[model samples]
Target: MMKRFKTAAALMTAGAMVLSMAACGSSSKPAETAQTTEAAASSAAETGKAEATEAKKEDGAKFKIGVLQLVQHPALDKANEGFVKALDDAGLSYEIDQQNASGDQSACQTIASGLVANQNDLILAIATPAAQAVAGQTSDIPILVTAVTDPEDAGLVEDNKKPGTNVSGTSDLTPVKEQIDLLRRVLPEAKTVGVMYSSAESNSVLQAALAKEACEANGLTYLDVTVSNSNEISDVVNSLVGKVDAIYCPTDNMIAAGMATVSMVANENRIPVICGEEGMVDAGGLATYGIDYYQLGYMTGKQAVEILRDGKNVSEMPIGYLDQEKCALKVNEETAKSLGLDPAAVK
Candidate 1:
């Protein structure tokens, strides 16, 4: 009986030992599964962090540009288009706030004040008056001027080689001699050249002076028919009809705005007009020998990019000219026909 009792006890002890070993093995497996789940969750969290970092990099890469154009004329419009294209080429997104002054100097000043208040990254001034307004409003903001005849005359810059101020941009002034030569080429018999421009416009005055010098060199007589405002355009144009053989239109914003009226009167009197910009040619002027306004805007856009992205000083950057290769002769067939002039004769 004693031996049987001892055997039963030993059997109970072995069974308990086996059960304990099985419980420990099962607990070990659950602990390993828990560790694996924690590791996967940690890896997923790290991946999320990396994606968020990349998204931030993408979100931080953009810029802002503000454009102040004098009017909606073709030359200034083309320059604005060129500026947009330049920004697009650089893969930078920009917010452009464009304002047209409708040929009002006070309106330009008001718009420029608002832009400066907004703290725009850069300002693009399309004409002489517009550039002057922006420069007067803010010295901290860089101003890029286009379609402006002479920055110096406009008082936007000290010199072309060294801007010496916060303003710099492309000049629309092509060689004055080339323009005079073009006039003579198109109208070989025209001895007396009549010029109508806004006397208030400094750019117009500078162009008039240059045109006068050019005409003198070519043995062509020049007559000044200056007008101070839009109201005087018709009178100025009518006054020059019989006295002058041909009319020369400078890149005066006021004159450009009133081109349709000027064209109607000039064409009625059988006078052919040679303008400084392609827009005037399109507006009923006979022809133009000038730089592409859009190309000038694009050139200015590049300078703006440098000032914004490359940390370059605007005062240090020399004013740049648009590539002259972009300059060309644009003639109007309808105007030529109406004036009894041949288009092919001008080129």
Candidate 2:
């Protein structure tokens, strides 16, 4: 069945969104949803009903958007919430088909293709993997991404200016050097930092390189550890426990989802874990010099409205950045105390 938002249509407005959604859990829905919806939509589009459905949008119907999130985690979830709140505040009535890939690459492919099959006006892909999956399925559909660290490095665009395709959105590339500086200030005696992330995510790889550079500049040894998926997080983190002074994780989706696992193992060994975003800090990270994901998502939501309502070309939209990066130190008081750091003074 087709999911439609039936309401009076008005131009989507660009507004500041304050509501941040709760962290998400992976969707247990079958991966066939995309295939099933695609087949159904193909049949409808063939029978002229699809055009009729689109005509409804011209007659006071809601705008439809399909959101494909890579996994259930705080950063991604906050971004999703901000996007929805942006739409609501713009007074543009809309319906969103939100799907989570459960940190599975194949699941991302299935969800992205399905959203394309359903023929949503625009597709919102959170995370690099989600964006890549949808971009692979169609270059014609406008895809707006958020929580992605580096779009150009991930091969999502030609460059920030003039994406050269039907894709563009916000980049959550916080300053790695500042995050490392935060670690040095807090753990002044630490000599080696362990950097962990998903091996498969290009964004994580990019951030990890910057992290290594930051560590070098601080005269700290960099220990690298990576995993292909969440199943390896605890064991991998455990292996690196005594060998490093601290752990640094970028905005890697896999690590973000299993951060509690990373935190549990690392904290048990009394090592401080520094993260790339506030959501990670909230999860179990000792601290982070990170960005507010809610604001990032709101920015992506504004891009969505611009493409759908203002008739702007997404390919030329110029990859968006926080006009002023909202990066700052956020510490988990409990985690800090566990590591013997003065939580209040650290802040």
Candidate 3:
């Protein structure tokens, strides 16, 4: 597979060297010849290619995307994968410069500032904080956010229906009410549900509020437990161990990353956790009405194409949401059984 690349690279280098030699040895054969013209043509073609390549190097493609991700976690990673996959499917040429904030808001600010300075053709911000950081920096550059629960609440857009700014993209707003109801169906006799999320993420805070409301609407008591970061996750989970009959985790990045600990504590207490997304369910939450992050990102990528290729204004583009079909009912049989609930009945 790499053989052609090596051959082509060698030919390009050779053409450049021959062009240089011809210039130095021009006096020896001052008159133009067919052979000299051919060499000159080949050299000129190579030079043009070199210039094009340099432009590609500087911008990646005529279309460049600077991606700012809030953290290195499974759900966000999948969203980024889907965003790239959509761009690939569209057959559009693009360059992606991805930066991970490693769960640090300060890192997100620095990365967002650099991306704005680079003057990329577009910006892909994953998660709420990442989107907020980029939106805070520049108003001129087009920014598209993925995996955000509420873009308007995060202040990334003026309206969910119409952005009215250079910010728009997919929202991974999982069905909180449906998830809470599913928890009820799984554990009917259950009384209290602990809602866990990161206090720092506006998305999580918003989702937690929605989840709490849903719990109240569905005749279930809700307990709110929040952590500022992963370091506080285990202790938080432990504190909720015997206090709640079940746990309902929101579409939160920090909670999603530390779900293993949450699950460990939940399982030990025989509490089934109903998560906001599928990755959390897979991470050991009993079940969820979850959205596929990849599909969310893929849809966002298509939106990006409209802006880059069709000159659509981000300000006019409405924020996108995953269809209900994109969100599915997923239950972990093993977790269900361990909690003494019949898997089918849990469904």
Candidate 4:
């Protein structure tokens, strides 16, 4: 995809260069042909000059973009990459200042302030915390948020369909009921599941509630385990070792970052960990029927281009969502093996 974008940009540039060179070559033609070539050369030169001017105008309109990410986890990182790739592919001229809060609220506030001070043309917030921080700093700046569970629940937007504000983007809200069902299919004998996430993250709290409802509907009992930060991850997961048959982890930033720790303890106890997204499965989870963060980010990036290049109103832009077809089964075969489960069977 990147190669395609670069090639398209190169072709646009090459067209102007070729036309200019043609006009110059025509100028050096013989006197006999000069009479004929003169008219042609003059026309060619004018067209070439016009095209060059237009190209220069496009190149000169460089947008200033700021990216505020909540942490350094793979899911958020992939979303960030996808967003940037969209800008590059669109051939939009822009400069970006990317900042990560490293899962700290104070750091998020500080970074948000700097971005607002810099007065960026657009801001891409990778998670709920980053979105809230940036949104609090300015209501005028066009903000695009990705990897968030429920934009309405997070208080980032007035409504998901019509943001009615300067904030709008993609949601990483995976199919919670389907995921819970996946856990049941993977562990037929499992009766109790541990729903784990960081209590401080509102998105996680929302997902935890959904997981609980899903569990009840699926005729399974659930145990709620909350941690405030990464340091408490291992201990919390360890506490669930013998208490639950399996674990359901949400797309929480802190828990995503500490997935390895969670998997280490859970797998050691022969407990399967079903995650909310592919990155968590890759990190160490047994499986997940979840959305792709890269695609979600790319979806958001397309929205960025619509606002920055097309001059579309940010407030009226509806929240973007990946279709159910975009969700796929992702499994860590090694983790599945360790838990004495067949990866093929889960799929």
Models 1 onward score TM values of 0.81, 0.83, 0.81, 0.83
Candidates 1 and 4, the one with greater TM-score: 4
Count steric clashes of candidate 4.
0
Residue by residue across 36-121, what tens digits does model 4's lDDT show?
A: 88889878965763454356447776788999999998889999999999989998888999898988999999999999999787
Backbone N/Cα/C clashes per model: 0, 1, 0, 0
Q: Write the per-residue lDDT of candidate 2 for residues 1-347, one digit (tens) a residue.
A: 12232221211221112122211222324446777889888777645633544465477577789999999999999999999888877777678899999988999999998999998878999999999999999876789999888888888999888899888999988888999998999889999999998889999999999999999999999988999868888889889977998999999999999988989999999988999988888888999977888988998888887776666788899888884455667889999888888998778
Q: For candidate 4, which ten residues in a row score worst on lDDT?
A: 48-57
lDDT of 2 at 328: 66
Candidate 1 per-residue lDDT, tens place, 129-223, comes to: 89889999987677888888888877888888898998888888866577778889888999999977888888888888888988999899989
The window of 10 residues in a row where model 2 has the poorest summed lDDT is 10-19
Local error of candidate 4 at 217, Å? Answer: 0.9
For model 3, the run of ten residues with the poorest summed lDDT = 49-58
How does model 4 fare in lDDT?
A: 0.89
Clashing pairs in 2: 34-114
